[model samples]
Target chain A: MRSSYDVIIVGAGPGGSITAKTCAQAGLEVLLIEKRQEIGDPVRCAEGVGKEGLIHHIEPDSRWIAAELKGSMIFAPDGTEIKMSEEASSQKAGFNLERKIFDRVLAQQAAMAGADVMVKTRATGLLRSNGSISGIKVMYMGEVTEIKASIVIGADGVESKVGRWGGIDTSLKPVDINTCTQFLVSNIDAGEYNKFYIGEKYAPGGYLWLFPKGEHTANLGLGILGSKCGTVRPISLLHKFMETYMPQGKIIEMVVGGVPVSGPIKQTVANGLILVGDAARQSDPLTGGGIINAMDAGKIAGEVCIKAKEKGDYSVKILKEYEDRWRATIGKELSKSLMIKNLLIKVSDEQLNQLAHSLSGIDTSKMALPKVLPILFKKNPKILWELRTLFI
Target chain B: MSVIVNRYKCGYCGACVGVCPAGALELVETWIEVDNTCTSCGVCAKICPVGALVVIK
Candidate 1:
């Protein structure tokens, strides 16, 4: 890496790559770095993204699109299955991605857009000048060096250190995190729809998901809340679930990780520094999805950086625009989802079965969640009252 | 040792590093390092999805 550039973005994930691409397209000198030797290896994500949100960034390509889903099925602990058709599902239609390829494609796009991309480059610390952020200290190829930049963007994933080093409070409480594990299983009949199983018996304070990758193969995973994890590990819970539900399936690969269900942090900007993606806690609290959210935040960050460049200012005041813009859009959804997630965890398994039963009668093909929400509210007025923000 | 990491099972996803309240854990590329700041709260051990981190008194 050179000694100086207009911007330095840490992590070449979807968020960082998008930010780099956007900034470079605007003629800003950009440097995007990934600590991994390969830009998208060691994938940790389940790789499901909404079709609508994805098309906004790049067109879906067969090389990376693993499966196109048309609907979803929610299985309550009591074996009550509630089906949702394309229209009923929130994202209408969705795609399960091959993140290994998709992330690299995004980084390649950023590189093609003129951003200098490097792998095996890790940021060690933030370089501060007179109590103000200036740039970053990176270790590239076993050599430590200081690279100066007008603005530094932290697009790092959940293990993000940039935000913390920059003095931003990005801490997550035990209750705010979901400890998760997944397996790539072959010889499974997952069909074409996404499947979800919920209840304390299956995955306490969380749920299990089966996202089909292709014919007879699927990504089966579960995420349990940290506070609810007493003695049973997430992987153990998944094993029990598999033994009972998918005994014939063979596990070929295992992935373990955590998702921030804490919603967005209070401040994502410091003097000459900004945080985006998982670093800013932008992942969805309800579903623990971050891919689309990260891309959205990255887009906004790049746009704000451009405006800041025009004014020759990279101070906290100018950088706050990125936070404000994302808060107005993605942040609003995260807040509501957090409230709903908090309430959902408190619900009993019996109540969930009741919920599924209540919705089983509707013409699911034409029904949207909003259409059935009123009927549900009538049955459970207490939850409806708590979720008032969603209505008004 | 306050915390012991089973690198064999660790996926290096940084889940433990993210939930370390004391900020004592760091993901150094493919492995994780526990620093002196660890409070032995067992939070990292409990939150490690694969049971890779063990906190022993």
Candidate 2:
């Protein structure tokens, strides 16, 4: 392996791969590493991505698309369902992806763009020189080797060591993390629309999702506040949910993971090292999804890395530009989403049922979730009074 | 890279070894260890049946 490169990315997930691909395309030396034997395996997500969000970063490929969605169904605790049409769902109604294929495609794009990819390699530590990141220490095939790089990008997911090693505070409070469990089940019948179930009984402080992958298969999952559900395994909760909702379905693949429901980290870059994806807590605070945000952050980080390379400056001060740029792009939406998440958590089951009823037949085209709050409140001013606290 | 496996939470199902890209994970006396070349990708931590593995920097 070469001892040095212009850029070294720690993970080959969406964020890292996109950064590497972008930099490589700009004629910079880049190395992308994946700790897994396969570029995409042991899928950790619900495999859902927004159509518009996916299109914003890279062109969609048929190989990765499992199903295209038209809309979503929102269910209250009492099972009252509110269906939102595609025209009204905005980009929030995205597609259910085949993550294995989707992740591999991103990594392949990076490799094709001249980035060196090393699978089964782990970045163990940061190589530092006088308090600045100079390179990385990697363990590959039982041999510890040091690789030098001008810039290092950490796309290593929520529990990102790269960020910690680089002296960036990536710690997430228990309240900020959502424990998620999902299963790919067969023999289920659900509409083309993705379904969301909300209530403390279903998933306290979070929600359950039923994403149809095909006519007979779907990814069924739920996320709950990590701190509130002490010692209750997310997988067991998932089985309970499945038994209650689709008792006859057989689970084919089980996936357990955590989603960083926190907003973006205060700092994403520092002196030759930058963080992206879950590592940077770029996932949606309300929905606990990261594919879109990760890719978006990756693109911005990649662009910034190229500029820094050209200017021969890899200082933290120089990289702050990347953080500022992304904040301008998606930061506002993330903050708004976080507020919604908090409000959703505080609502009672009865309130949710009422809210569903109010929104049932309403046309949502050109309207966002927040915009619908007032209309629901008008139906019962008491509920509106209780929810008013959220806006403040 | 070293991986600390919490025996209390580890089911030893070997999912970590199955998904490890570096082939640096294995069941040793009912425990998983970071082989000499372990990359610390935390894939093992991510795939562990019981969330037993925690990667420390």
- The TM-score of candidate 1's chain A against the true chain A comes to 0.96
TM-score of each: 0.96, 0.86
Q: Give the lDDT of residue A282 in candidate 1.
A: 92
Candidate 1 lDDT tens digits, A330-373? 99989978988898899999888877787666666545455556
Over 4 Å off in model 2, which ranges?
A: A85-93, A365-371, A377-392, B1-57
List residue ranges in candidate 1 displaced over 4 A.
Answer: A86-92, A367-371
Lowest lDDT 10-residue stretch of candidate 2 chain A: A84-93
Docking quality tier of model 1: medium
Per-residue C-alpha lDDT of model 2 across residues A1-392, encoded as one tens digit per residue: 57899999988888898899999999999999987778767777888776778887777777788888777777899998776544453444678888898889889989999999999888888998866799999888878899999999999886577887788776665567777778888998866888888898788888889999977899998877765554555567778887876899998987666777777668888899999888888888888888888888899999999999989999987899889988887787788778777777888998888877877677754454566667776776776675565455
In candidate 2, chain A reaches a TM of: 0.94
**DockQ, structure candidate 2:** 0.09
**What is the C-alpha DockQ of each candidate?**
0.77, 0.09
